[model samples]
Target: MGDVIPAPEAPRIPIIDNDEAAARRFPVRRIYCVGRNFADHAREMGAAAPAGKADRGLPTFFLKPADTIVVDGQVPYPPGTTELHHEVELVVALGADAPPGELAPERAGALVYGYALGLDLTRRDLQAAAKAKGLPWDTGKSFDFAAPVGALVPAAALGDLAGRSIALAVNGEIRQHASLDDLIWSVPEILHELSKLYALRAGDLVFMGTPAGVGPLRPGDSFQATLDGLPPLSGRILPALA
Candidate 1:
């Protein structure tokens, strides 16, 4: 008889709410983020913004571990960086898988479960250094407790995102603001583009992208991210644990 291998401890799967009532649970699977989806933000980052649909390029995708999600509003200041930046973004949650192969943008909207506010915390100094050396941004963007998301509202309940606004405030001052209409790549387009590279599945989260006002956070700073008609995501930066 073959002996069974002893398994280690079960990993924690972070759960997010699917509705304002918090009755349903949505376990996070993978976190996929789009880089520079906002034209203004692209320009601010020193990359040229696409002039029109013809010139618009593909969305840049990156990932962070599912465990990095922080729902409790407590963000410990990550170590190894003097500059921690806050990028407020709209978070999209998938409820179902798309058909195999390239997902058509027109059909991608059906897979959406809900939307939420999210903060894409970044280690700016590390990111800048990596960019200068033409290196990957894993260390700069993917770290412990790097994503703080708010409770989600069902997509059907929220209706169209056409007139919505996303904004972030730091210590009571507005830091980033933009309209959903300003996105270079819409939600459907992002999902469609992402499907070409990876299989689209349920429980996947996509951070749509941030606006132009990316800035720093200190140990004691507090931040708030908001998307029109949805509950705001708020958290404080505490000194890193020893």
Candidate 2:
């Protein structure tokens, strides 16, 4: 038997519309992440990402608690790590529950509520150590304020997301840069694959993976990220608490 106590409350993030009016605070139910979904990024990691019509490697995934999300330019430099990395990505929030079974790519848009620019902050050293030991790396990716995001833009207000550039800059210097076209799997394909494995529902946020240049972070460091069709997301790395 487990401890006799009430369950803890799940954290929530405010969803403001980048286009116009603000959105209601979305109760985060779950966070799904896609890993190494870019060819060049894969190569940089010393492996090749599956591609072509015949390539059918199972999609890599991970999860973070909703409490990890932080917004409004306030990202804290977490403790217990010397190497903190920033990964710029397009965050997808689902509007409706995905139908159980294999979902076709055509219907993926119907399930999307909006999009946003998110930084998947990682403790690269801890993550690498975990990988070396064949252990779960959630400790590296799911730390406090690990997901710093910007406003959510309604899907209808956007056009083609592909071919657009997504980049990150630190202290006014560009670090990571890539086009949306570099994604190994499209948003629709990711949604389709996720639905087959997990129970997809409204308020679910999916981190669509990062591009090649993943580097370190320091206290008081400023980070600015821009996804071509989405609003720019910026934040500062706060000093670790005493």
Candidate 3:
């Protein structure tokens, strides 16, 4: 054998534990996000989709690289915008192997290994400018420390989340509130649609979507994300580095 090539140094994503054990580290393949999957949220953003029912075709999605994910609220406030918004969402962590194609709803649940509450932090002003200019949302939505994820609860333990409540609070004040019942697409439905878009494999993460009441965040502000049947995720936003 010739000289073995040295591997390049790269960061891996840290995932919270469902049980009372140490967190697990996984090689994040992709960070897939569903846009405006909640009716109230869509309406707030002037989207045409309604909240209670599924819209025609697949839901809108965006991507973030695996390098941006951090466990819980360990990230500091990201720079580049005066308007940073907090969007709490239900995050799904896939564990089993899934082929590239349409995935059946019945078997979709089996592919999920765990669930967690995640914050889809965004630079709203940048996003708006990008939208107006017809540019990609990568800079607005995908950035360093953009995703603050909580502990992962094994899917078998979380079970069906039909009635679970998902909410976000700032400085101990409730800002966003909604239930999984209001989701336009359920977990399985999301997975089914996602399978058609990409060849999903083990360790891929999906941020389901957020409810209404999304708003801006400032330095010294503390935010908390909660999902019924899962551990709460809390973090503080520090001023941008001078």
Candidate 4:
């Protein structure tokens, strides 16, 4: 027999769902985010919007730990920020089909397992401070319960991508709305770009960025996020610890 190795504890795999198929839990590996993929949102955030395919540059990338996913509906208002913001996005879940590294854009779709709606919650004050000091956005972004996602709907079940709409509402009032076509970088393109950077693999989730109208979220605020035919995600901001 081989030598036995001891470990402190078993790793806890973060899980989402394959829609109502609760028996099949989608274990999350890592969370990859594409920043400013929506031209309107980029402009709103004081960045230049790409006018066409030729002028469109590489997608901005960032990461949030997989455990940040909040599936249970109640999201605690995070600490260290007076300005907490919400950015709803179309999330793409990858399967185990693709070999790691350097995937071509045209063939990237083959790696998709499903899609879901997610909220990319942000601490805007921290983000702005970091930006002013030319620092990384980890403090503003990656935090406890930073990514709240809905169930994953298989890629095979999705209809034409061009026919989808992504929107968000706070307390029943619409704050952001946009057609999927508005994304500067499509899903496949994002995967290809990401694969070039990381060894993109199964259980990876990509937040395809958000549209204009990202705004503040406070305690007791309830929000709803919807993607054309996928499951909608709704959550309430719980009061912060005193």
Weakest 10 consecutive residues of candidate 4 by summed lDDT:
7-16
Give the winner by lDDT.
Answer: 1
- Quote each prediction's TM-score: 0.92, 0.91, 0.90, 0.91
- The global C-alpha lDDT for each of the candidates, from Candidate 1 onward, is 0.89, 0.85, 0.84, 0.87
Model 1 Cα lDDT, one tens digit per residue, 166-208: 9999999999999999999999999999999999888899999
lDDT by residue (tens digit), candidate 2, 9-120: 6656565565245456666788899998877777787877676636847668899888888877787788889999998888998889988788889999899988888888
Over 112-209, each residue of candidate 3 has an lDDT whose tens digit, in order, gives 88888888989999999999999997899999989888777787877788888999999999999998988888889889988888988888899999
- Kindly report which residue pairs in candidate 2 clash with one another: none
Q: List the candidate 3 regions with Cα displacement exceeding 4 Å.
A: 1-27, 51-55
**Candidate 2 runs further than 4 Å off:** 1-23, 51-53
What TM-score does candidate 1 reach? 0.92
Error of 3 at 3 (Å): 11
Ranking according to TM-score, highest score first: 1, 4, 2, 3
* Candidate 2, poorest ten consecutive residues by summed lDDT: 14-23
Regions more than 4 Å wrong, model 1: 1-22
